[model samples]
Target: MATSNQGYIASELARNDFQNTYDLLVRACASHPERMAFSCGDSHLSFAELARQADALARYLRHGLGLQPGDRLALQLPNSLQYPIATFAALQAGLVLVNTNPQYTAAEARHQFRDSGARAILVLDRLLPLVRAVQADTAIEHILLTSVDDMENPRYDGDEPGTQRFMQALRIGAELPPVEPVAGLERLALLQYTGGTTGVSKGAMLSHYNLLANIIQTLELFGKPGLLEPATDVRIAPLPLYHIMAFATNCLGSVGMGLHTVLIRDGRNLDEIIEAMLRHPFTLLTGINTLFVGLMNHPRFGEVDFSHLKWVTAGGAALNDEVARRWKQLTGAPIREGFGLTETSPVVTTSTSISPHRDGYIGLPLIETELRTVDDDGHDVAPEQPGELWVRGPQVMQGYWQRPEDSAQALTADGWLKTGDIAVLDAEGFVKIVDRKKDMILVSGFNVYPNEIEDTVMCHPGVRECVAIGVPDARKGEAVKLYVSLKDTALDAEALIAHCRQFLTGYKVPSFVEVLDDLPKSSVGKLLRRELRDRARAEVG
Candidate 1:
């Protein structure tokens, strides 16, 4: 296995036999039918059982819903057994899966549905109103809603009705007709949206080959065989499923290895998570810097048992030195940070789980991924020099869905994905992210693109122009701060903040709103975010 300082080259792990993601899942299921595949709370499913359910769901989609393989199906659910089942089922049925944040507003939901050309949606009942609001304007032909406790052990008050309905759907057993398998590795399997250079969320077209290749590369890195027993090795998954990090690491990675995944449905439920950790003795825990920091600062964090812990992987944002030190002290395990974008099937380079280096560096590239830091002119830079990181590997996404021009801009002529992240490749091949080339803010591991905030704020009657910049913060690693020039003097900072809360998610809402007579701009009238960021830093200092 040829490896790099970053880890392993993805080219070495890339398989020519597997055509798509569905084929990979089918292969895994066939090879490990009796292995434990998934767990959500007390509910568990074996590989055989999961495969059956996926086949059943695929049948329902084809026969009952009349959805074709290429049709898009949006999934708005948390981390659960159903998520994987639905995802694989969609792939098996030859449909493209579009993942949406369950907490998205009607506006956000509508934009994604319209952009992805989603013909159907499988969502949670709690988020039905948001979907309904957007469904009218979307190409959505069918809506399937699930209850919160659908797969829980004991029947809560919420479980009975939806479970009964779901059971009825299963009992009907609609025979699905045979569907042809499309082996276009470059064809889209997922429409993963990210806040692009322009700030508007654009779908990254991840083909079946892209996703499957990532899974293969990831599994090769693990080098572990057999199911990870729940009694011995459990994985803590507090992150949301919508994010590619959680999707790849927790959902797909866990399933591929037959590892038991304990889903923290709500990350805010810190006490419950700690308690569960104490009870289950989780060996591997993965999350962002803020999550680990919050846990270490929690009053009861000291009481939790970390004796059985083996590995902790952090990503989605930069890991602070202080946070990493405190986490290591509390858990007796170093928090290994990594670098990746949603466009790269999420995992490009990660630190070793067995022998982690505690120097705040995202360890080596995986088996078949290539990492190179390039200067402004696309020339490779020297080691330790900060430049835009260019990744070339199987994990890289195919292109942006329906946006050929955007795709052309993102991918280099030599097939490398131009990750707009400023990073340095050390002498040993370890990659350390220094900054972002794009104006994007990381709030609690969520990507809050400046353009999204600017657009939302500009809609306010009082706001003339606004610039959103990331400001250094002690807790969240970075906070969203808005510098706005008001059209009406009567529009105050407090009022603007209040208005934004209605339109944006809590993380996307700016923590600090500064009222200004004018915003800094270039000669061409482009908002200068760097100037605002510098001004904010100077003021804080």
Candidate 2:
């Protein structure tokens, strides 16, 4: 028998609760073959259809495309029926899935493809040009393209050179011999890239066991009233599949739980998201502070029936107290906030229905998870003291892809993954995130590294030097604000912002641009981001 103690699961239970992800998928299919597994727009796929399609695509990827076991496959498609189809198929084909941001620029996509040495990619038809632009710089050999209209129409119409329609590939795959599931859960499953503290992007090498453990941990905490059980719940997936939060929850966890997840391709469109919610009346809803606020503010938001919403979980960014309170006030459902990183399979601590929602605290650690706060000297900090948060669990990532040095720096010798966020642990074992040790800006629950933003801004010939910092934003929680020292005095803020937009994603682009004589710097000539942030706050005040 195992008992919960101090927000940690018993050691015996932790060691024995082991299941391979692929095995779990097979079990799910066997248990509920006809259960609706996924929904995107008007197209829905049952567990049987998903299994068949994935196997077909897996066969095509292995035999048709010559993709060998352990080969990396980049999935740059948005949230849709095709995403899960490609994801499970790649796993079945014994390929490492590289979860790439669909909104990434050509340069951003190139760096990931080059670093991972991906042999193949599945991208949206509209984004085919982006892949082609970066094709010369990477080892990509095969391109599988899908369109928004592909699922409903079942068409094979495409004229791209050296590329084939994804639907057609699936058809061909169904005729070929079935690909067997890869053995062993220790094999690499995903290369989920995240912005590093050192300002470079690194892929977190997550194995099948890591993801499986996390899914189990999440279910142990949140599994109640069959919220995730097959054919019992409908979960609204407004988050992108590429992100770790949504990846672990909707794409992997919910599937095993037998949940019918409605995928939203473009979550940014508030109207479309609202319409989907109205149509589905989902029981499980997950989002960040921004989305919760945006929906509550929408004119037609009050029209939707939220009586069916079982829970609303917020992650990827800090939850504002006001936002949480407002959501509860409106929907009678408290917003349960959790915390995690890309390295930990993206789930560490989450507030369950059994726990009380304390302001600013991220709640207890999941089952089989251990967390502690350590001072700069690596000594454990006392309760109520803020320090660097360290985590140890089966869900923790193996390491960064091909970067031993970075991996060594992030993980301790004894195996604790050093989470860069500052946190405080209470006597009750509940965790509260105080602040981020790194200067990464989280805009609308998306990581917008300041270094990446400043680098792109400096590329403008008119900018001599620039500094990017996160400023408090009403809607996004925090937004990027850039200050520039101009090479050409006539260079205006509008032009520089436009230049950044060309390279950065929509959220990474600066909301406010200010022209300054020179940026504040330390005696050694390092830009003082703290000083700029303080000045911005003072000006705002």
Identify the candidate with maximal TM-score: 2
- List runs of model 2 lying over 4 Å from the truth: 1-20, 224-230
- How much is 425 displaced in model 2, in angstroms? 0.5
lDDT of 1: 0.78
What are the per-residue Cα lDDT tens digits for candidate 1 across 53-113? 7777777777777888789999998777778888878887889999999888788888999
**Best candidate according to lDDT:** 2
- On residues 1-541, what C-alpha lDDT tens digit does candidate 2 reach at each position? 1115433333423454433456656767888889898998899999889989999999999999999989999999889999988888988888999999989988889999999999999998899989999999999999999988689987686788899899999989999987888866789999999996556889999998888878777767666654444466788999999999998888898886788899998888888789898999688888988898889999998898989776788999888999888888899877889999999998999885556567778888887788889998899988999999999888899999999999999998878999888999988788999888888889988888988988888788889999888888878989889999989998998898789889887888999998999988999999999899889978877
| Cα RMSD, model 2 | 2.5
Global CA lDDT of candidate 2, please? 0.86
